[model samples]
Every structure is written in structure tokens, then in C-alpha cells.
Target: MIYRKDRKVLKRVDFGAAKNSLMGVLAALVVYALVIAWGRVYEAFQLETLLVGGAVVVVTAFRLWLVARFDALYGAGPARWRKLFAFGLILHALVWGLLPAWLVWRVGTGFNFFVVILYNVGVTTALGSSWMAGLKVRQFYILLMFLPVIGALFLGGGLREWLLALLVAAYTFYLFRLYRGQYELFWHAVTRERRSGGAERRRELPASTDIQLSLVYRLAHELRTPMNSVMGMMSLLEDTRLDDEQKEYLQVAGQSGKLMITLIDDVLDYSRILTGRITLSPDYFDLRGAMEQILEAFGPMAQAKGLELAAVVDRLLPKRVRGDRDRLMQVLTNLLSNAIKFSERGEVRMDVDFTAEGEHDGVLRVRVSDQGAGMDTDTLKHLFEDQFLDGAVDAFAVRHTGFGLLVCKGLIEAMGGAIGAESVEGEGSTFWFTVRLGMQADMSESSKLSGAMADIQGVVVGAGAGSLACLQEEFEALGSQCQGARDYDHALQALRAGHREQAEFDLLLVDTHGRRELALNLCRNVLEDPSLRPVKLMLMCTIEERGEPTVQRLVDKHGLVTLVRPVHRTGLRIALGRLLGVPRSQPVQDLPTETPEERRRRKLYRLLLVEDNEVNQLVTRGMLSKLGYQVKTVNNAETALALLDQENFDLVLMDCMMPDLDGFAATRDLREREQREQRPRTPVIAITANTAEGAQARCLAAGMDDFLAKPVHLQELETVLRRWLSREDDSAAEEPDSE
Candidate 1:
């Protein structure tokens, strides 16, 4: 693992590893000196004594070298340095721990014998206090240092020897118990020091926008690609035959993938929570069904860990609710994961409470309790605060809890709720959160699109005529007004013309148009105009123009979204989404009046699946075909679009990124064609591997009806099918009085 700049704690941990190693070397030197001073006294054992002394001296020399070069290598890289430190620590422990035992056994029943035994005990004591010991008591060095001496002591036959061995055995037991206290004390002290010293130095993502984008980049590139393969294989394999053992293995693999995806989701959610940009997609959901799914998902995990997992839902808790189901589940799942992680074997249980506020809404409070190592008051006070990231008293156990709990807090508060914790250091902990939400929505409630971005203004100015028509059509297809200008002056005039009525145009696309000097001046004028500051400026330039000094200066100075010439709609939506936010969807009143029964009646649905990855196409096609829908697969957006023109399909499962024509661009093209030809809009659902922050927004902005992350699950696929295929009204609300 590399030591990143923001995680200063890693530096401190490495320092702990690198420090005090010199003293360990010094301890070895003392043993070597003892060997030399006493070896010559026993003449009869002269040869053996010399050999022992020489070996100790040689090992001591090596340790001294290790101590010298050790800390210097940490700067080289963390993983290599960590391995080196472990190798050296194990070497020293094995040598120093066995030397005194070997010497003591070689010369039995004498003061010098007692002296050797004392040295053995002293070295064992040294190991009980080592850096690695702090992380774990049964660490490698502990086993190396303690086992040999303790085994040798018991091997002696005399009663007195047996008694001394028993004493040392008791000492070893004491050391284990002592380490437990020291470990907590170590973290407690660390937590206090960081708070006092670094209260103001906490690492905050520089700007929320940068943070969201950075996390999104990592999720899409680093996390989701591998996960797509993992979950994809898992989903594909599920449709095949398998023995029970094989099924179990597949189940575990699937569970592991689920947990990994949850962790990946948390990273993005935390960023959203931190930036106050996280949206809760409130809809109809079964509270009981969600609870049952969570428990079922975590059952194997708990059973694998030998911990009992249980839950208690209050009689008053509603069985259905209209709320952000995913977020609610995420918060509870986070709590369950933390409880399971901290517990060794005891039960981790969830308890729910509810209080009805009216006929339609009420408060939901959930508590997750664990019989595990808990936190001290100091730690409990700062659990949700950033300063606690130095970690809580449980050290390794609580390491993963820090930001997760913070996200829970942010999410709960955002739902007009609150979250907190209660713990007694040795007993256990209970984490809880509360949210006020409406009871289950009426199943008949029609799907409604948020209408905030129903209409907006955009202007295109560029000599890049190749892209102008595409850009103008894309904007109009999204229900936005877009005007093209002949040049910089005309562009400025177009923007000023819309100024009074628009207050601010949603976006301004400026193409360098191979006229760098004129384009550069237009940018300066637009930026200088106070009235236009609110409008997002997107600069389109050629390869040479993009790198030109003045253009680069303009981009860097103003933080403009710069794209290479012949900008694709997919790239344009992402860039603008980051600046202007998720494309607003059409108002409910503006949507086509398609009846639910009309959609549900199309059972023999012809579906078009567009994806570049062959494996994904196979996996998706197989999964969809299993449900008995006629499926057509294409390698990219262009092929899919060409096919749609030739054959009629009930819906399109469009992958957002592909060759020349990406999903967003393709969807826009199809929509533009449909609008121009007076064809009814086809239901286009975006299937993408990208977890970028505004992905859903971009999809909706491009005219997609819905969105799904890649490596789609069978159950989720089925749900999306029912929801979109016929505008499925599956989640019927229960009577408020029903449990």
C-alpha cells in the first residue's frame, strides 16, 4: 500500500514501526556482550561457549546493520519497507529469544544458569512491548520470542526447573492480558494527541466538486471494472447447474462481491454527504422486505465469522414506506458491518422503533447493537467527527468504522433525522439513527420525473461546423433552447439578448473554431461580463489550440470545461453535468400519457441491448432472455441505433460509453430522430459501468428513462423490468394501521 498525502496517520504508523528498532538492536548487543563476558569462565565448555558467543556476535552485527538501514528505506515505499521491517523483526526475535535458552540449557544448575534464564525472560519481556505487538499480541515476533523460551523451560526435568517454568508460563499469560490494556491505552493516547494537535489540521476534501470527481474517477476506473467482471461472472454462473458445495462457493463469492460494491458505494456516498450533494431517490419500498434482504445477505457473513446475527422490528414499525430505500439500507448495512467487524463471536442485533406523526408520515429509529469490544468516552465523543479518524480505542477493529459512521450521520441528518452512539468500553456498543419519512406510497402513484430543469438556455458559437448541428440538436432534444452564432460578437449578442429574461443561460459552448485569437478574446469578454458569470462556459478547441499557451491559461485561470474539437455528446454531458449539474428531466405534465396497462401488456417485448464489452452483452442477454423477452445485442450505440430504425423494439438497454457514438449521444440521436419523424419515444434505459457522480443526471438529460450500474443483479434486473416494462405497480402500500 502506498502512503497517500492526506492519510497522515499512515506516516505516524510507519514512524512507530521505524522507531525503537535501534533499542531492539541495543538489547541484542547486550546479549552478545553477556555471551563474551561469561563464555570464557567455563574452561571445560570452551569450544561450545565460543561458538555460542561468536554466533550471538554475528547475529548482533546483522541486527545493527538492519537498525541502521531500516528507517531510511521507509521513504523508498511503504510495502517494501514494511516487508523489510517484518523480516528484520522476525530475525532479531528468533535469534535473541533462543540464545539465552540455549546457553542456559548448555550450563544447567548454576548462578550463570540463572543469569541466562533471566536474559531469556528479559528478551521475552522486550517482545511483549514491541511495535508489532501493539497491532496484535499474537503477532509473528511474539510467537518467535515466547514459544521457544517457554518450551525450553518446561523441557527441564528437575522440580525446581518445573516451578521456574511454571512461573514463566504465568508471566506469559500476564503479558497477553497486559497487552490488551496497552493496546487500548496506545490508541487512546494516539486519539487524544491527534485531537489536541491536529484539531484544525483534519483532512477535508479541498472542494466538494473535486472530491466527488476524484472519488468517481477511482470508483469507475479502479473499482467498478473489476467488480463488473466479478459480479458478472457470478450472475452468469448462477444460471448454470452446480453441486451444493459449488453453490456454496458461488454464494460466498457473490457475497464478497456485494460487500465490495457496498464499500465502493460508501466511498462515493461519503463524498456526496460531505459535499451536501447526495440525493435521496425517495420512492415506494417495502420496509419489511428491505430488512429481510439485508439480514439474508449478511447471514452467511455472520455465520462464517461464527457470530449470531439477529434483528427485532417493533410492532409499530411500518411494513411499507415511501422513502429513499437504498440510502436507508446503506445506513443500516453500514451499522451491521461495523457491529460484525468488532464482534468476535457474540450476536449482532438490530432493533427498530417507529412513531406515527400523522396518517401519512412518521419517524423511524433503528439501533444496531453488538456484543464486542466497545469504545472509551473520549472516542465515543468524537466518533462522527473527522478528528476521530486517527481511530478509536479498538485500533484495527474500529479502523473501518470512522467515515462510515460519519456518512450515516450526514445521511440521517439530511433526511431530517439524527444519528448517535452509546458504548461502555469493555461491554459493547449500540449505533442508532432516526429519520422522519412518509408511510408506504400508494402503489398506483405514477412515475414522476423532477421538473426543475424542464427548460434551460444554451448557445453554440464556433467554427467547428462539424459539431454545431449535433450540439444544437442534442440541446433541443432535451427540451432546452439552443441558438447558434456566426462569430464572437454574435455569440456575445446572443447571450446578452437572453440575459434579462434568462438571468443566466444554463451553458455556453464556445468552439475555438480554428480561430484562436478571436476565440480567446471572446472568452475574455464573456468572463469579464458580470451578467454572464453565472453561465457555465465550455470551451471546444483543436489539439493544438487546447495546448496553446493562451487557451491553457484561460482554462486554468477560469476553471472552464475544455474539450477537444468534435466534442461528443457523452463527454459534453459529463463536463456540463459537473458544472451545471444533472440534466433536468421533463415535467410530469409534459411526459407522454402512456398507460401502465398498455406497457404491462407488451409481454413478448422486443428489447435492444447496446454494449461494447462482449462479456457484458452475453451476461445481460442471457439474464434478460431467461425472463422470456426477445433480445437483440449490438456492440456499440451506432449499431443499436441502426437496428432500431430497421426493426421495432419495445425498449433499449443502452450502455452509456461506446465507440464514436456513446450511449448518451446515441440516445440523443434516437430522440432527435423520433421527434423529427413523429415516432413515439422508445423506453431507453441506460446500463453503464460508469459510477460518475452525475451519471444518472446525464442519462436522464440525454433522454434515458432510467439508469442501472453495471454487473447488474438478477433481482435488480427483474425489478427494473417490471418498473419500466409496464410501469410496474408492485409496491402497493399497506394500511397505515397494519404491522
Candidate 2:
């Protein structure tokens, strides 16, 4: 590949071969001269021989000197390839061709043996030299070697001479081919050496890269271990009686830890994608279930922002579809997260519809649209370019490489899907993607919206066309009759026209996104009208608008239900259920009193925590204890394995990285041992800070029943416990004494 560059390398191969062959050629010429002089050969033949041999020796010596000079100026580019080739041809012709032809004509058969020997020596010496070993130079030398034989073949007087000339010509051709083959072999070796040198450098780069990535991963986990303890301790402290100042301090500490955790997560995610660690695990999962879980995770966040978050799925879509549930959730979470981060007042909505479906598969189009501060053309151009998030940086709230949208793009593409965004700078943005999923034939129809708000009449006013359409559809889906109005005036006129108590709608939904003032005035007018005053009033306002005095007065004094911006279909259902006295199918979980046996059962629920770091162990143990769990921790996997035989653990919290027998190996061993002894398999949860893409899958492959990352929150830990341990076996045990 670097052939052109190699031309600059003055090969030691050339100079060494040139010097050796010069000695051989000169010696051969000396032998020829001595033979002629000693024999007292014919005067003419002797003179001719002396002249030719003298010329040959002088030319050969000069050529050798030239080669030396060329070597010295190899890098100077003065001796072009064509010049070298011409020189080789001319010199070889004089020594090998012309000398032989002249001897054949003057001495005839008498000195033919000497002539043959001289020709052999000249051609052999030239072939042996590396100076003319270049492909082009060697070719020229071969051509010159055959010239004398060709001349003698037509001009020879005898058959023997012609045959001898033919043989010599054949021999010359054979030597040239041999040297050419050798030249090619040598070139190949050189190229191979250069390539291997480059390969070695390339290999070294990835090795160093691997080392650096490993260090970052380890450092992140190490940092998370301590932060987990601090946050967990703070959470425990918050549960205890504390003054407002102490509570605020703990809150600030918790917030800082959460932010740090987010940053760590972003780093790990980018690294995982960069290192090709992510892969899809497709399985049939409830689409509704996935959507609901995301809503649940971000509902509090949306609510905190005083925003509405909801999903609207197509009615004909399959209840369960095949896809990577976790990854899809992650993508949606990232989109929803970005929406919430940038949106201060408007709604964040997720819209899902069936794009295509067959007997065993379906394609779903998902869009996470938000009425937030959108992007300009310039920002959109580089929206997905790799960069770190910073304060006031494109509305990203974390300090990490690339925004979440980049990660979403990678995941969607990996899933054989495409993603894009549409935004108006001051209006909002909508991010959408399409994914192929397997169809669940056996799944029942979804009950998420079944009777969510029955027997209710509602009117949505002053909402954007999209928002108004979504709200009306949601209400109708919940068995309610609803109508949409473009503005507050239209809604007020409709309410007044239906003045009869029975004909009037029971609920009024107002969008305060752009017409907050008009919406407030309408709400006040509704309160004044006796016919409309009884209607349950729910005003949608931006987070910033919700803090305004007028909005607060409307909510506090007028007893109006307030739904935050970007209201979800589910969120709307919940808000409607509260306002219109509609009974929800599945109410929020309520804590019930436990009897003595229940308490005893809970006390018996045991957890074995396997962690190497003392801080992690303490933090984990404390968090578990706060949840009324009985925990036994060991510093290594060996001790954990030993304890499994001594006591039956309901669940094992395995730390993936340890001094000996890491979580993966330990889980595998535990699973094998349980199978051999025919004992009930205990659940092993990987409690690692290793957030690499395939880390959880690795744990699962190693027989882990679940995964919980480091600085495990109390809720996640409790959820893992409840999922693995039977509910009847669950109990609120007495908190263990602090160590």
C-alpha cells in the first residue's frame, strides 16, 4: 500500500547485491583476459577480446559506482525509475549482448567457448545484482540479454552455432524469470512487514481504549457506591423526626446525589453505545403495561412540573407485542424526560398507533409530543450531534455526553426503526419512532380505560386543536360524552345554550396554554351562572401559570380541579374520576393493617446481600432494614455461597464485581447447586453499580432473577423483594438496631 513511499527507502538490499556482483563480474573478466594472454591467441581475436573485456570491466565498475551514488541520494528523487531502467538496459546490452555478438563474428567457433562463458558471466552477474532488481529494471535487462542470441540465430553460418545460440537465449530468459520471481517475493515480504507494523499499532490503540473505558466504568461504580450510601442514609434520616432545616439539608443532599447518579447513567449509556454493548431482547409484552409503567415513573415528575402526561393508543392495536420492553421503555423514558425537562407549562403526550400488523408481528408508531420550549433550525441541525449537557444547554438538565435524544436514535436504529423530530421554537416538539413487535394472540383486551370515567358529560375549551382532539377522545374512551371547543367564548356560549340542569355538561375542561386570561375569565363567568356553577371545573395551566395569583385563587377559593399542562389520557382519567365522582376500576394501592401472623411472616422473609465494599453493604443493609427486611451481608461470593447452605434466603442481593467469584459466577454456581440438591431455587438479584448495557442481561444469563443497580433506592429494593417473595410471606418487621 505504501509502494510509492517505499521508493524513498534506499534498500540495503540494492547496495549489498550490487557490491557482491561487481566483485564476481570483475573476477570473471580477469579470468577471460588471462586465458587469452596465456594461450598467445590469434592477434586479431586477442585484440578484440582485450578491447571488449576492457570496455566491459570499465562500464561494470562505473555502474557499481553509480549505484552507490544513487543510494546516497535515494531520498532526493533525482534517479527516477525510468532513468534507472534505461541505465540497466544500456549497461547490460554492452556487456552481455554486444561483446558476445562481436566475438561470435570475429573468433567464430574457435573461441565460442570463451564467448559463451563471458556471456554467461555477464548476464548472471547482472541478474544477481539488486540495483537492477526493480520490476521494470529487471524486465529491461532480460530484453537485452536475448538481443545477441536473436542476432546470431539469423546470421550464424553453422547449425551447431545456431543451436548453441538458441540454448544460450533460453538460459538467459530462464535466469531473468528467476530473478523477477525473487524480486516479487522480496516486495511481498516488505509489504507484509509494513502492514503488520500498522496492525500492531492499531491493536495497541484498542487495548489502551479498553483500559480507559474500564477505568471510567470502575470509577463510576466506585463513586456510585458511596453516593448510594449517603443518599440511603439521608432517606433513612428523613423518615426520622427532624426539623425543617435538617429536612431541607437532607433534601438538597438527596437532590445532588440524584443529579450525580443521572450524570453517571448518561456516561455509562454513551459508553455502552460507543463500545457496541447494547443488543435487543425481544419478548411478547403488554403494550399497555409498558406505557402505564412509564407513566407511573414520570407521573410524579410531570405532576411536580404541574404538567399533564398521558398516552393514547390505537383501539385496534394488540394488547401485547414482541419487542425489547426495557429498551423501548428506555427510549420512551428518554423522550418523555427531555420533554419534561424543557417544558415549563404545556402538556407532554405519548401517542401510539398501529402502523402495520400481520399474523405474528406488528409495527407500532410512537410519538412523544410536548408543548415545551422547542428548537430553532440551527439547534435542530446539531440536535443529535455528540456533546455534553450543561446548565442552559439546549434545555438538557444533566452534565453528560450527548443528550438523551442521541441515545434514543441509537436504540431505534438498532431496533430496525427510524426516529425524527419536528419543533417550532416557541411552541413545542414531537419525537416519533416506529418499531416492529411480535403480536400476543392470547392476551386479553386492555382494561386500562374500561369504565375509567362512565356516565360523565364533558366539554374541553380553549385547547389547541391537537390537545382538544386528544382530550375528547380520551373522555369518550372512558364511556363519557365529551365535546371540544376552540376557545373560551365558544365554550361559554355552549354552556349558556344548554342552561337546563339536565342538558348541561357535568364537567368543563379548559386549556390555559395560550388563552390563560380568557380561560380564567370564563371560569369566573361559569361560577356566576347558577346553571353552570354546579359543573365540575378543571382548568389546564402551564407550570408557570399555575403559580400565578389568579390561577391559585381559582383553585383555592373556587374549588376547581387543576390538571397540569401536557395531560395524559390516563392522567385525564384520574382527574376526571376525582372531579365527576366516577369510580376507577383499579384504585391506588392502600396500606392495610397486618395481623400477628402477618407480622411474623414478614419477619421471616430473609434477604442475603452479597457485596465486597463495606460502605455498599452498610448502605444496602440500612436501606433494606428501613423497609423492614432482615438482611445478611457477606463481603465475598464464597461466604455468600456458604451461607446459602446454612440458611434459606428468600432473595440474594449479588454485587456483580468482587474480589473472588463475582456475581455472575456465584449465581451460576448457586443455580447449579440448587438443581443438584433438588432444593427450591432462591432468587438472586444482581445489586451492582455496573450500568453497562449488557450488564443486566449478563446477570440474567447467570441465573439472576432480577437486577438492582448500586445506591439502590428503598422503593426499588422493596419491589424486587415483593416480586420474588410471596406477598403472604411479606410482613412489616421491626427495624433492626443500627450498628
Candidate 3:
């Protein structure tokens, strides 16, 4: 068995060693007592016998008392008691060691007297050897005690005495070796335990599929809990003063963590679907808005591969549709993810079209097309089957088709949709699904929305023919007339010609591709010309160019706008609006400055946080406090209930997994108490890493008001709080005045 040096293990060893020592001392005392009893029974009370028996009784009583004392105090005063115990052993050895020699010298070689004295000496020597017990210092005491007997044997000056001395030396050597072996064994176990600690004892055997799924789910939750803290703290760090390079590094770290969390979520989702526990919750949502978010989330992943991600929604499509928004998002996300994962270059596009429409119901089709390595006929034939991902895929490797696709198909089917794929073996693939959804009653709001960039004339320069065409389409959709030129010189010549022809341009768009120096040279030329000075300049630069001194000089020092390449339309539109000095026709809600009321509300919010993990508790508490909430933490549910009984709280953030009285039980009990006591229910929100399909339903059924998956984003935290915290329960506590 693997060993650990925990307190329980150490205590067992120490007590066992202490008991062995005590038993040796006790045995020595018993021998001395027996000698005294024999002397008294024989009625031989000579002065020498009296003195010897009296000394024996006195030493025996003293040693008995010492053993008792050692036993009493060893646990509390190990260092002090050990020394006293060893000293008692030495005294017993000395009395026995010298008594035999004294008896030989005094009793004139009497048979009975020699028998009694040698018997006592022999017993004491055996006890001393056993008591040595691997301690070098105790062995020295044993040797010292035996010296007198050896000296007495030599003084006798006979072959018998010499033989006795030789026998004694041989026994001593054997005892030394025994003690030395014990010493090595004990220390080896201790050192090994110390080095391994408690962690190494975990089993190393591979787990079965069910066990693997359980472990993956658990690991996903545990890992994401801390990663959430890391990403949250990194986001907070951005508000501090960091240079471009430092910020870039921090951003990369944050992006990696986000990617890891996404992978974990995929595993969690697949596990849920595998167990037949997943359920879809349908609601009305903005179709275009959801698509926009999907594109935004995957923007970095696509850009990393030099790929463009595009989302196309038919204008006639309903603005809001009733369906499982989250599930639909998951389906599209999985498809897009696989698209990006297998593709090296080119654009990954999502197309949303209405196959059929009515006032109440409509058929919506979504196709995710990617220029990636396509599937063979055999692979396509078994795509959605249960065994598709069974044996062919490695558990730890990046899979081309497996559980993720399985989950996507299951989710789509659950939502009353059919999923299919079209592919060419060497070219690319398109995966599509169609679902029925109800249209929003009010389509006027959707029709009222207008392009943000109206009444603008823009010119694009030096983009690849394909990219340039896409840029033109994006700009034209925004009600701007966009002209493309073949290259840099051609664009500059066209601009000069426009100036000569008295056609003044409103905006100048430049695509740097990857050459910073070339882009900078062109920028300088445009800035130097008086005719093009009024034409607002915006550069679509690569990720590396954002940190360049030349680009920084142009943006910060010279006031030019820069947008990173493989641009999403949202970012592009925002850049163009900023350059043109006009807000979008749709009111864009940027991060707002805090109002006085908002500050007041933030200060008044109080939260009770219940969690068992100390690290998660500390990090989450810090994050919540940083958001301006007053937070009190308890390690377990029992303490939480006790605290809630004594004081009032605005909300409680409960952790589902905990030792003794978990969050679910605590929430249930609280609800019962509220009912019995005729009091209003205080809002309890579950914050957990468990993302199994029914986790939220379980939380709500157990009387929690809401559930938040672990590693909650700051924005998500805000949204949840806004939804639940708005209902001020005066029965729990008076709402803070907005004065």
C-alpha cells in the first residue's frame, strides 16, 4: 500500500514505539522485584543480603513509578518524557550490571547467591538490548551498564569467565545489527511517506467509459471554477496601466482560458446527452442577435487561422422566433467549431434562410458551410449513428467527428428539426438543420431598424479580389457607395483623379494585408496630400500591426482609426461610425458610466456566499466584492443556515457541492422554514461548476431562485443580478431608498 505521513499515521508509530520502551522497563523492574521476594522468603537477613534486597526493592519501586510517569506524560511532553524514560532504563541496567559483580566479590562464590545475582543480571541485559530499539545513544548506555560484569569476569581469571565475556560480546553485536535494521526500515517508511505526501496514493489504473465520463464532468467543473477566477481577474487587470505587449500577452492568456472552458463545456454537454438527461427549454429570442453573438464568440478562433467567419440572415426572416435559443446556439456553435477546427484557410459562413413562412409559424433553415477537409462516403454514411464515435476516436485526441457532433444531432432532433450534411471528399462540407418557430407579433420594430452607416462615399485599397468584394458588399449594405481599386498605387491615383474631378470622398478604407511598412508608406502619402486630408482614413491591419510604433503613431499621435483584419461587420461598422463622427442608426449600448443611483445600489447590495473549497471561496469572494457587493462567506451549509437565522441578507449565493448539508439541502430547509414561519422567501442563487442538463431544474426545484454556471462572466453576473435583485423583498429586509 502507498504510505502517507499524516497525523494519524505518525501518532500510531510514536505510540507503538513508546509502548515497546515502557514494556522493556517494566520487564526489568519485575525481575528485580522477584529477587527481593525470594530473599525475604528464605529468612536469610544478613547485613549484605539486607542491603542488596533493600536496594532491589527501592530500585524496583522507583522504576515502576518511572514507567507510570512516562506513560502519563509522553503524549503531551514527548521530548521531556523520552529523556526521563531513557534515564530510568540506564538506572535499571546499572543496578543489575553492578549487583552480580558485587555478589561474586562479597558472597565467596556461594552457589545460591551467584544464581540469584546472575539471573537478575541476565534478565536486565536482555531488557536493555530490547530497549535499545535503534537509538545509538541508548546502545551506548547498554554498553556502559555491561562493562562492570565484563570487568568482573576478567578479574576472576579463568577459561570459563573468558568464554562468558566472548559470548556477551557476540550477543551485543547481534542485538546491534537487529536494532540497526529496524532503524533503517522505520526511516525508509517515514522518508517515503514524507516525499509522496497524500497525493500519490490515488489509483493509477485506467477507468471505464462510465468512470471516464464521471471524471471528465468532475474535472470540467473543478477546472472551470478556478479558470473563471483567472479570466475574471485578468479582465479586472485590464483597467490598470499595462503596455501594449503586456496587454497582448494578458489577452492571449485570457483567450486560452476561454478556449479551455469552451472545451470543458462541450464535454459536459456531451456527457449530459449521453446519459439521456438533456432537455431543451424554448423561448422567444432575436434570431439575428443570437447569430451575431455566435460569430463574435468564434471571431478569435477564426482569426487565429487567418479565416473569415460570416453570418448571413435573410432580411425577410422574423426578427424574433420562439425556440430553444440556447440549444440552437449550441448546435450552431458546435458546427462552426468543427468547421474552424478542420479548416486551414478560407471563410466559414453561416446562412440563415426561411424555407416557408406564415403569420403564426415559419420554417427556418441554418446551413454552416466551411472550406475544410471533407468526409469520405463511409464516414458520411455513419455520421449520426450511435457508434460513429465509439472506437475510432481517441479519448484525448482532437476528434474530427464524435461526441460533439452526436450532441448537435441529438439537440437538433429534440427541437423537432432534421440534421444533415453535404460534402465532397477532397473539397469541403456543409451541415444544415431546419426548425419550426413562431414569429413575433410586432414586426414593425424589426422593419424600423436602419443601416448605421448611411449617406457615405468610401474607397477601398489593396485588398485581395475576394476580400475586396466582401468589403464592398458589407459597405453597400450600410448604404454607402464603396469603390475598389486594384492595388495601392491604383487607389491613390484614383483618389487624386477624384480630387481633380471634384468628387470629394467621405471615407478612405485601407487593407494592409500583412505588410506594415507598405501600409505605413501609403498612410504617409495620404496624410501628406492636402486633397485627401479631409477624407477620413481607416486601416484594416493585421493583429501584429496594432502594437507597432508606426500604427500607434498614426492612431494616437496622428488620429487615424485602425481595425483588426478578418473583421466582423459589428467591429467594422463601429470603426466606420467612429471615423465618420456619426452614431449608428440603432442605438448601440456601449459600457455606460455609472449613475449616482447605480453607485448607491451597488453599495447597498449584500450577499451571503456558501462554498466549501477555500480557494474558490477566496477568489469568488474577491470578485464579488470588487463588483461592490458586501459579501459574507461560510464554509458549509450548516454555518450558512445558522448565519441566516441570526441576520438578514439580500441574497445568498450557494454552492451545490459541499461537505455535510450541501446547498440543495440547505435551500430546501430554508424554504420549509420560510413556509412554517410565514415569512417571504429570500432569493437564493446557486453558483456551481456542474453544467449537467438538469442542474438548473434541480436547483430551482430545491427552492433556489436562480442558477449560474461556474466561471460566471462579469456581464452574466450583472445580468443575473439585474433580473433577480430588482425584486426587493421587504419581508426579508427593507429596500434601500434611491435618494
Task: Assess every candidate by TM-score.
Answer: 0.47, 0.56, 0.57
Candidate 3 minimal-lDDT segment of 10 residues: 444-453
Model 2 clashes, total count: 11
lDDT of each: 0.67, 0.69, 0.68
- Over 343-367, each residue of candidate 1 has an lDDT whose tens digit, in order, gives 8966677777788898899888888
lDDT of 1 at 310: 55
Lowest summed lDDT across 10 adjacent residues in model 2 is found at 389-398
Cα-based lDDT at residue 310, candidate 3: 62
Q: Candidate 1 vs candidate 3: which has greater TM-score?
A: 3
Please give the distance, in angstroms, between residue 679's alpha carbon in candidate 2 and its true position after superposition.
10
Best of the candidates, TM-score: 3
For model 1, what is the alpha-carbon lDDT of residue 56?
63
